[model samples]
Every structure is written in structure tokens, then in C-alpha cells.
Target: MNANVLRYSAFTTDPAGGNPAGVVLDARGMPEADMQRIAAEVGYSETAFLLPREDGTFEVRYFSPLAEVPFCGHATIAATVAHAEANGAGEKVLHTRAGRVRVQVDEQFTATLTSVEPRMAPLDPDDLDRLLAVLRWHRDELDPALAPAVAYAGAWHPIIAVSTRDRLARLDYDFDALSGLMAQRGWTTLNLIWRADADTFHARNPFPPGGVVEDPATGAAAAALGAYLAHNEALPADRVFRVHQGDDLGRPSRIGVTVPEDPREGIRVSGTAVRITDAANQAG
Candidate 1:
């Protein structure tokens, strides 16, 4: 690829772990088709292309190998850290298809992104039933305390909480069925979760809509989970929680999420990223 495609692993400091994303720091004037092509060539779950504006802000677009997505949290973090390493670490606004996302880059190059206003919606019973059947999960396996619902924070993800951590670890689902249902509902991912306590949880994300079987680390889903916990009063107000993911897939990652007192405010999802010096490296 002729584009200056940089690779970075998000949510983990080690390149061997976390989700890998492609970042095109200067993609101004490039056609959308070209950006999509680069993302396809890179073969990551998602890639970010940034168009710098005169106001020092960026108009960002995210593309998976198969299609364009409204938002991608991992890609946002990877791109911001790459920019901070070159420019200075601070804050900036990114205009995405979902909304304006505010990002802060610390001196350590850990990027924290505040999502757009989040909202939750009830999942249709029929659809939820079908999803459960596809995942081979029985109704008894669900956690009644955490109702299944769809949550959005820049991107839409269906939140499904299981009864046990063992159930969360054994994730095998029908890709076609899940992908068809997700595409019909415009869902970016299925946020499958298991809560260990008030402040600790484990998660897995199925992103077949992005042509990936599963994502090692999903920041967007983590943000939606935080909003869900807040909306349901499942946790204390103004709390920060930890999400452990991808351990079953051998790409262990950790994500931290904070919910504010205000219900309408965006959830903050923060994590560190490691730069993959070679663009040819495997990520995600």
C-alpha cells in the first residue's frame, strides 16, 4: 500500500496482545474507496483514516475490511497515540459518523476517549431468543439481574450477560446467524459479558459484521457496557471498572471504563497502545 499505514496494538502495552488497528495519520483528500482498500489490505478489524482540518481537529473515518463502521474505539486510540507521539500529548475532538468524540493523550501516550452521549434500548424478545439459540446458550444461562439490551456509545452493541465466567469463556456461535441479525439491526458488535463483582468483569465481542470472528479487545463494547451498568444502576455512581478480555483466545487485554454521575454524559474508556513497528505485522 502506498499510504503511510501505521500499525498499533490497542488496549495493551505489549504488541503480542490486544487488538491491532491500522492508522493513516494524514489521509486528507484521499477517496473513501482508497481508505477502504487500505483497510482491507491491512486486514485488521478496523482502520482509522484522519483528515486534518484547519481548526486542529480531525474528521475521522473508520473502515473494516468489509464495510465502513460509524465508530471504532480501538482504532481511535491507536490513531490518537500515533499522533501524540509525533505532535504533543493533549486533547482533541474527532468528528466521526456517530458524533463528536473527545480524546485525551497523556504524557505516557495512553489515550482516553470520551464517547458521545450514550443511550440504551430494549432488545426485542424474538430477536433475543434467536440470538440465544444461535449461540447455543440456554435461557437459564442468562443473568436475569442484567437484562439483555442494546446500548450505544458511538456504535451499537447488544449487551448480553451470562450467569457464569465459564459460560463467557466458552464462546462458540453461528457466524452467519449473528451477522445477519446484527446487519439487520445495524449493530457493530455483540457485547457478551460476565460480571465477577461490582468493579470487575470479563467480556467477549463478536464482530462478524466487520468480517472478524472475534475481537481480542473491543473498546466500543466496553464503553457501551459501562453505560449499561450505569443505566441499570448495577454499579455505584461515578465508578470505574475493569474489563478482562481475549484470554480464551490467548490475546489477553485489559480495559478500564468509568461512568460519570450524569446519565447523559459520555462514558470514558481508557487504555494504552503499543506501536507495531512493522506494518506487515499481524494484529487483532
Candidate 2:
């Protein structure tokens, strides 16, 4: 209960933008219940707890207000930046429930996390139907170029690509229904996206299972999205793209993704994080 938690916003230099996350630099003996309580108190989309090991690696856990997640991208970035500010900018390996995640922090406070080996699976027809129904979206609105699928890179996300940006902007969904469906399917968030161009995309994530209505910036989903684009062969020539998220919510976050040619390799998600001071926190 007396843990020293630092607040940070990831994917944006401004405190008002991006996704806010709580970072517990040292939670060596904290119980799972305490972590959950702290996460709820923080009231962010997610919080990260780090327990250091003898080998210098850290065993990390991510928690939302409702439950624990296998992995969380924004929290990882925020924690890494906080760690870098305290220690020094360098690389660190995080042992998460999903898998080992390698993270690097630069002098500029930019952090890049390499996701676990990503994979994609076909979405069940019945599940897709239910999902679309809950979101009040029809099949005709979907983008045929990017087939719907469940993509995983440290966490599982259902990728739903819409044809137009306007369709993606109007995000009105049945919260309770979507929550039940996500919980039953063990999905972390629904990655709703629309391709702006060959290298630019817009995303909105619905995280009902986490007790969050929507996530302004979702790093894990961005990694999963990279895998989805690669699997569908929809990547541009460079296999790099920018994800613009949180604009609808007025947060305005930017996430950079780099997809490797090797399907078995991890995707690289890069972004900057800024510490949320007491005044900034109060303002937010």
C-alpha cells in the first residue's frame, strides 16, 4: 500500500497526450492483490510493476482496474522511461507472463520495445459476427484488403480494419456486450483501424475487458497490428509505418512501428514518454 509509484505518459512528449501509466520501479514483495488495488487507484488504462532479479532482469506484471493482463505496451514504455530517468538509458529485458520482452531506452527518453514472437490466427466467423453486432458495424464497412484476424504479440488483439476513417471515428459500441465477448475470448483489446495511406494508419482500441471504455494509445495493439499487416502483405516497401491514435479523444498520440521481414521475429514499437509531475497530474 505504501509503494512509490511514478506516473508517466507514453508515446507523446506532452503530458496531456498519449496514454498514462503508473510505474512501480520496485515491487519486490508486493502481493498480487496490492498490485491490483494500486492499479485501480491509479485509474489509468494499465500499471506496471517491476521486480528486479539477481541477473539484473526484471519480472514485470501489468494490471488494469479489473484484472491482470499478459502484457501491456504503454506501461512498458512508461516504466522503461522512468527506469532510464532513475538509472541510465540502456537496454533491459522484461520477463512478462506472455514472454521475454527486450526494451531499449535512448538518451532522449525514447523507448523501443521488441515484442514477443508475433503470430496471427483466423477469427472465428461466429465471433466476428458477434463483434460487429456489438460495435454496430456492418460487413460492408470492413476493409477487404486487410482481412480480420486475431493477432498476438505479447498480447492478443482482434484486428478489425474499416474502409473509411469516418467509420473508424464514429466509435459507439455496446460496452457490456463487448466486454463479455472479450472476456470469453481472452482478448486484451479490439484493434479497430483504418489505413490512411501506405505508411500511415489511424487506430482506436476498445478495452472493455480491462474496464476501460477505450484506450487512447495502445502499444501492444500496435505491435500486433504490425504483425497483421505483415501477415496480410499489406506493409509498404519499408515495412515501417506510423500509427495515429487518441486523436478522437483529443489525446493525440503517435506510435512508430517497424516490422521485420522474418515472420517469426518480434515487432519493434518506438515512442517517447514524459514524466507526469504533481502539477501536471493535477492538471490532467
Give the per-residue lDDT digits (tens) of candidate 2, residues 160-198. Answer: 999999999999999999999998999999999999999
* Displacement of the residue 88 alpha carbon in candidate 2, Å: 0.4
**Per-residue lDDT of candidate 1, residues 141-253 (tens digit):** 99989999999998989999999999998999999999999999999999999999879899999999999999999999999998899989897544899999888888888
Task: Give the C-alpha miss distance for residue 98 in model 2, angstroms.
Answer: 0.5
- Model 1, position 96, has a per-residue lDDT of 97
* Candidate 1 off by > 4 Å: 281-284
lDDT of 2 at 238: 96
The collision pairs in model 2 are: none
Question: On a 0 to 100 scale, what is the lDDT of residue 54 in model 2?
Answer: 97
For model 1, where is the 10-residue window of minimal lDDT? Answer: 275-284
**TM-scores for all predictions:** 0.97, 0.97
lDDT of 1 at 182: 92
Model 2 ranges off by over 4 Å: 279-284
Predictions in order: lDDT? 0.91, 0.94
TM-score of candidate 2 against the unseen true structure: 0.97
Give the C-alpha lDDT of model 2. Answer: 0.94
